[model samples]
Target: MAAVGIAVVLGLAALLPTAALPCGALQPDNTTASKLLGTWLYVAGAAQFPQHLLELLLIANGHLQVEPGAGEQELPVPQRVAVGDQCLTNNSTYFEIAVGNTTLVKHAKTHQTVGTLMNLSSEDVLLIQYQLQRERTYLGLYLYARNLNVSTERREELERYAKCLGLSEEIVYAPWKTELCQVRDIEKGNSPCREPAAVVTASPPPGTHRPGSAGN
Candidate 1:
C-alpha cells in the first residue's frame, strides 16, 4: 500500500496540472478535487465491460492514472495509461478525462462527464459512476476503497447502489479477491511523458479498452 501511494503521487505529479480546462467554460473547483484525490480499485462494472479486470485506477492531483493489473480469467497481461482530469464547473458535478498517451493508449474524449460519482462517503468508501464507450457503450458504477480491504457494511452499501441503478447480478462482479492488487508502478523510474499543452478538442467520448489490452 505504501508503494501504491508513492507510485500514485508520482504519477499524478508527472501527468496532471493544477487545473485542466478542456473547454473554455470549465472551472477549477476543489470540491471534486478534494473528494477524488486517491487510489481507486476497479471492483465491478456493467456486463461486457471493457476495462482491464482487477485493474486499480488512481485519481489524484486532478489527474488519472492506470495501475496495471495481473489480468483476469482470460487476460494474461493488462496494459495501462495515464490521464489528466478537471472539473466542468464550480459545482464539481461533472469532470473531463483525457488520455495521457495518445499514441500508446486510447483516449476517451467523446463525452464531457467521465466521472459521474466522485463523493467520498467515508474515508474508505467511495462510490462512483462513469461511462465507458468502446465499440459499444456501457455504464460502470464502482465502489472503491482507500485501502485493499473494506468493511462488510461497505460492501453491502455498494451492492445497494448497484441494485438501485438496476444493474444486473450477472454483470456486476468484484475483481479484487485478496488485498490490494500488486500493480505495475507506471510512474517509477521512467522518463516523464510529455504533458498535453492544451486539452484535446476532438476525439470520441472517453472509453477504456477491455481486460487484455489498453484499447486500440
Candidate 2:
C-alpha cells in the first residue's frame, strides 16, 4: 500500500503543473481575420520555454512575419510565412488559434499546430499559443501589443495571464528599446523588412525585469 501511494503521488506531481494552468479567455466566434492585421510590439511574454522579444506583423490575406530582438541572443532570422487558409477554432477564445503554414514542422520531425488568439482577454493584447502531440500539449504563450512600452496596468494583466497559464518561471522581460525593436508600422504601408536603426539609449539593460515583464 505504501508503494502504491508513492507511485500515485509521483503521478500527481507530474500532472500538477499542467492541471494548474489557466485556459485563458476564449476567442469569440464573431472575431474575423481582418481584425488581426497590424504591427505588434513584443512588450511582455510568458511560457514554459525561454522568452524573448519578437516583433510581429500580421498582413491581411498575406504573410505573418516576426522579428526578434532584446533579452537573449539575436532572434533567429525573421520568420515569414503565409497564413493558412483556415484558422482552427473550438469556439473558446482560450484555445482558438491563428493557423500558420501547416506544412512546417519542428526540427522537420514532429508536426506542430501554430495558432494565434487575437484580442484575447484584452483588445490591446494578442496571444500566440502552440499545441503539439495532437493538440494535447500546450507549449507556450506570447503577449504582443501596438505600443512599444507597456503600461503598469497592462503589465499586471500579462502577469495575471501568465500566472493563470502556469508560465511564471519562463517569463522574461524584453525591454522596449527603439533600436532593438521593430518601430515600423506596416498598417500605414510601411515596409516590413526595414533594417533596424542602430540608436542607443539609457533604457534598462537586458535580462532585467521592466514594467513589461511584470517587474522582478
For all candidates, what are the clash counts?
9, 7
Query: Each model's TM-score?
Result: 0.42, 0.43
lDDT of 2 by residue, 15-79 (tens): 12323334643334333333443444554445443222111111111112233224111111122
Stretches of candidate 2 above 4 Å error?
1-22, 49-112, 116-121, 132-138, 178-181, 185-216
Runs off by more than 4 Å, candidate 1: 1-31, 46-111, 118-120, 132-137, 170-184, 187-206, 209-216
lDDT for predicted candidate 1 compared with the true structure: 0.31
In candidate 1 the C-alpha lDDT for residue 183 amounts to 30
The sequence of per-residue lDDT tens digits that candidate 1 reaches over residues 1-216 is: 110211111111122221321111212233333444434444434322223221223211111233322321111111122222221101111233222211112222322333344333465555555433333344445555556476767766666555555554443444333322223332252313322333321111123211222112
